[model samples]
Target: MKLDDIKPDIVHDVTGTYCPVPIAETAKQIKEMEIGQILELIADDPGVVEDIPAWCSSTGQEFLGMYEEDGEYHLFVKKVKELT
Candidate 1:
């Protein structure tokens, strides 16, 4: 299935937040989710456009894709690692 076709299990809006906040919140949220669960992170921080994907790569999560709407970014991420 396409990345956008996947339904998110959680939607996080970190619009006004910057830098580490978006990534930090995403990390916190994904930890509570089961493997294979999806998270839709909505943010306006330009750093997240690169940070989210890089964080996912480093953490072994799946960075499905992202889209922009009304100057906001929607990042699709999937939980691939189990929290130990």
Candidate 2:
């Protein structure tokens, strides 16, 4: 499915936050989500452009894609497994 067409099961907005905050929040939120669920993380930190995908890779989740608008980034991640 297209990234634009993917409806997220949940959304976490960290617009003013930076670096680890965005990634940390994503980790915490994903832990509560079920497998196959999608997370839309709204962030203004440019670090997420690399951090999100790297985090997803290390965590084994699916890094769907990302898009930027109005100086903000909207990243999509799909839960593919459980986290302890």
Most accurate candidate by TM-score: 2
Worst lDDT run of 10 residues, candidate 1, spans 1-10
Regions of candidate 2 where Cα sits further than 4 Å from its true position? none
- Global lDDT of model 1: 0.92
Give model 1's TM-score versus the native structure: 0.94
Residue pairs with colliding backbones in model 2 are none
- Write model 2 residue lDDT over 1-84, tens digit each, in one string: 788699999999999998789999999999999999999999999999999999999989999999999999999999999876
TM-score of each: 0.94, 0.96
For 1-84, candidate 1 gives per-residue lDDT tens digits of: 686588999999999999889988999999999999999999999899899999999899999999899999999999999644
> Judged by lDDT, which candidate is best?
2
Deviation in angstroms for 56 in model 1? 0.5
Model 1 ranges with Cα > 4 A deviation: none
